[model samples]
Target chain A: MQILIIAAIICLALSFFADRGKTIAGIKRGGVMLLRILPALLLVVFLVSIFIYLVPEKVITGYLGSNSGAMGIVAAALIGSVSLIPGFVAFPLAGILISKGVSYTVVAVFITSLMMVGTLTLPLEIKYFGRKAAIMRNVLSFFGAIIIGLLMGVFF
Target chain B: MWKILDNFFLLLRETIFFLPLMFLLIGLFDVWVPREKIERHIGYGSGLAGMFWVILLAVAQPGPLYGAFPVAYILYTKGASVRNIFIYLGAFSCMAIPMYAFEIGFLGVKFWFLRLIFSLLVFVSIGFIMERFVGEDFRVREGR
Candidate 1:
C-alpha cells in the first residue's frame, strides 16, 4: 500500500512536470470518478462489514476444517465467495486449517474463491463493467475456483 | 452496531486511502496514454499477445480488487479488448506480487507456483468465454 502511494505520487509529479494543465485535469477526473462511484462503494463496504460480522472465522473454520468431501469443497467455495477476508488473515488461517488435516483441495477452493469471487462488490462491479460483464466474471470465477480446487485434489 | 461501525470504519479507512490515488493514476492514464497505443497492445487484434501483456501488467499492480475497476473502465474506453480486461481484473485480483510472497510462505512454493499457473489458465479461458458473450463492442457503464 505504501508502495502504491509512492508510485502514484511519483507518477503524479512526473505528469505535473510534463503537463501541469493535464495533471490538474487528471486529478479532477479522478475526483469526479470517485464521486460517481461513492454510493455503490459505500454499499459494498456496508455489506462486507455486516458479512464479516455475521460469518465469523470460527463458523468458517468449523465448516471447512472437518468436512472433507464434495460437501466440504462446496461449503468452502460458498464461504469464500460471500466473505471478505484479507489475505494476511486468510492465508495464515488456511495454513492452520491445513495443519489440522484439512485437505489441500478444499483449502484451494476456499483461497481461490476468496480471491477471485466477490458477492459484496457486485454493485460496484456492475457500476463499472455493467451487469452482464460483472455477473459473468463472478460466475466464471466461481466455476473456475471449483475446477482449480479439484485439480489441487489430484496434485496435492 | 459498534462492531459494525468498527468494521465499517476499518474497511472505509482502507478504501479511502487507496481509491483516490488509484483513480488519479487511472485518470492520468486516461489523459496521457493514447488510444492507439492501448489498442495496439490489447485491443481486439492483439489476441494472444494481449492476454500475456495484461497478465504481466496485472501482477505488477498492487491494491485491493476495487482498485482494478476504474483502470479496467479506462482500459475498456481506450479500446482494450473485453478478454484482456477480464484477464487483467482476474490476474490483479489474485496474482499481486505482495500477496505472492505471503502465499508462498503459508502454502509452500510448490502450492504457490501451481496455484499461479492454474489460476492463469482458468481465468484466461474464462476470459475467452466471456469475450465471446460480451464481444468487442462492450462499453463500460459510465457514471450513474
Candidate 2:
C-alpha cells in the first residue's frame, strides 16, 4: 500500500512536468489493458487461494524433497511454471522447504520456473507476442528452469 | 463460501499493490517513450551493447514480470530484436534486485550468488534459442 502510494505520487509528479494529454491517454490505455488481463488475474488469484489449503508443505516436501531425484526436478519445474505465488511469500516458503530437507535444487527450480514461465498469463502473452512466440518462451523457460535446477543440484 | 470470499478479499488487497502500478507504467511508457529511442538501444541490430543495456535496465528496474510484458510489446512493435526482448524478459523475471537480497538472506550469499549466475547463463542461452525459434515468423506473423 505504502509503496504503491509513493509510486503514484512519483508518477503524478513526473506527469506534472511531462505532457498532460499523453499522461491521461496513457492512464486510460492502462485501464483497458487491465480489463484485458483481469479475468486471468482473477483466476490465478482464485487458484492460489484454494491452493493454499490444497497444497500443504508436507505434500510439497514429499514430492520435492529427500529421495525424489530427477523426477522431482521435473515436477518442480512443471508445478512452479503454473504457480504464481508472489515473491514475498515464495521466497520465505522456499526457505522453509529447503531447511526442512527439500533439496536446494528443487526449491531453486520451483522458484525459477514460477518466475520465468507463466501459465496463468499465457492468454495475455499470446495476445501481445502471438501464439508461437508465447508458447516458445514458456516451453524454453520450462527447460531452462530444469537445466538451472540441475546445475544448482550439481554445484550447490 | 465465507472462506472463499475472505480469501478473495485478501488476494485483492495484495493485487491492489501491483496490478495498477504495472498497468499504469505500461500505459505511461506506451505513450511517453518514443519508439525511435527504443529501437536505437534495444533494436535488432544493436548487438552487444544493447544486450548489456537491457540487462542492466532489467536488473535495476523494480517490478514483477507482468510489468515487463507491455514494455516488451512496445519494444517489439518498435523493432527491438527478438534476442533483446528475450534477454529483457529473462532478466526481468529472474533477476529482481530485492528478490536477490531476499534470497541471500534466506538461502545464504553463496547459494544466492550461484543461483544468480546460473539464472543469467540460462536466460541468455534461452534468449539465443528463442531468437532462432521465433525467427522471421514472429516478425511477419505478429503485429501490434
Candidate 3:
C-alpha cells in the first residue's frame, strides 16, 4: 500500500516536472474516464450486495456450491462465460459462495472463465479479431478456464 | 446517507489502494504519444515486431474486453491480420497499466508479477495458434 502511494506520488511529481500542462490534462482526462466507468461499477456492486443479502447461500451452493461435481464445474463455467460481472464483484461473490459450501474448483472456474472467456462479448471480439481469431481465442480461453479449475482442484 | 457515505469511502479506499500504476502509464501514453505513432509502429501484418507492438498495446490498455472488442473489430474489419488480433487480445487480457499499478499497490508485487507472467504466457500461446491456423477470410468485413 505504501509502495503504491509512493509510486503514484512519484509519478505525479515526475509529471509535474516533466510537463505540468500535459500531466494535468492527462489526469483530468483519466478522471473523466473514471467517472464514466464508476457509475456502472457502483450499480453492479449495489445490485450484488442486495443479491448477497437476499439470496440464500444454500441456493447458490445447490446450483454452484462446492459439492456440485463434474456437472457443477460445467455449470459454474457456463455461468461465468455469460455473466459480465467485473472482477471486483466477482471475487467477493466467489468468497461468499465458497463460505456457503461451493467447491473451490467451481468458484475458481467461474472466476477464471469470467475474466477470460466472453460469449456475451463475442460480437465485439469478432468485430475486432475477425471471426476465426475471436472464435479460437474464446474456445481456447474456455478450455483454459477449465484447466485452471482442474489445477485448483488438485492444489487447493 | 450513511450507507452511501460508507460505500463511497469503500470505493475510494479500493481506488487508492489497488489502482495500478499501469493506468498512469496509459494516461501518459495517451497524453504524450500520438495515436498515429502507435498505429504506424504496430499496425498489422505478420512478424515479430508486429507481435511485440500488439503486446505493448494490450498491456498498456485498461478495461475489459468490451472496450477493446469494438476497437479490435474495427481494426480487423479494416484488415488487421489474425496475428495482430491475437496480440491485441493477449495484451488486453494480461496487461492493464493503471489497474495493475493499483493492484501491485494493494495486492503486492509478487501477485502482480505472477499475473503479468501468466497473462503473457496465455496471450502469446493463443496468438501463435491463431497465426498458424486461422485463415484470412475471417478478417473483419470492411466498414461494417
Q: For chain B alone, what TM-score does every candidate structure achieve against the true structure?
A: 0.65, 0.64, 0.69
Instruction: List model 2 lDDT by residue over A42-148, tens digit each.
Output: 76667666755567757767788867988889888888988877664566457656765789899889989999999998887887778888898899899888888
Model 1: clashing residue pairs?
A: none
DockQ of each: 0.37, 0.35, 0.34
lDDT of 3 at A114: 81
lDDT of 3 by residue, A42-85 (tens): 66556654565567667777777656678899988898889887
Native-to-model Cα distance after best TM-score fit, residue A27 in candidate 1, in Å? 29
| Top candidate (TM-score) | 3
Best-fitting candidate, scored by lDDT? 1
lDDT of 3 by residue, B34-130 (tens): 5456666665656777677776666655567676766676666666667777668757754656556544543356545655555566667776787
lDDT ranking of the models: 1, 2, 3
DockQ of 2: 0.35
Measured against the true chain A, the candidates' chain A TM-scores are 0.59, 0.62, 0.68
Please give the C-alpha DockQ score of model 3: 0.34
Q: Give fnat for candidate 2.
A: 0.54
Interface RMSD of 3: 4.7
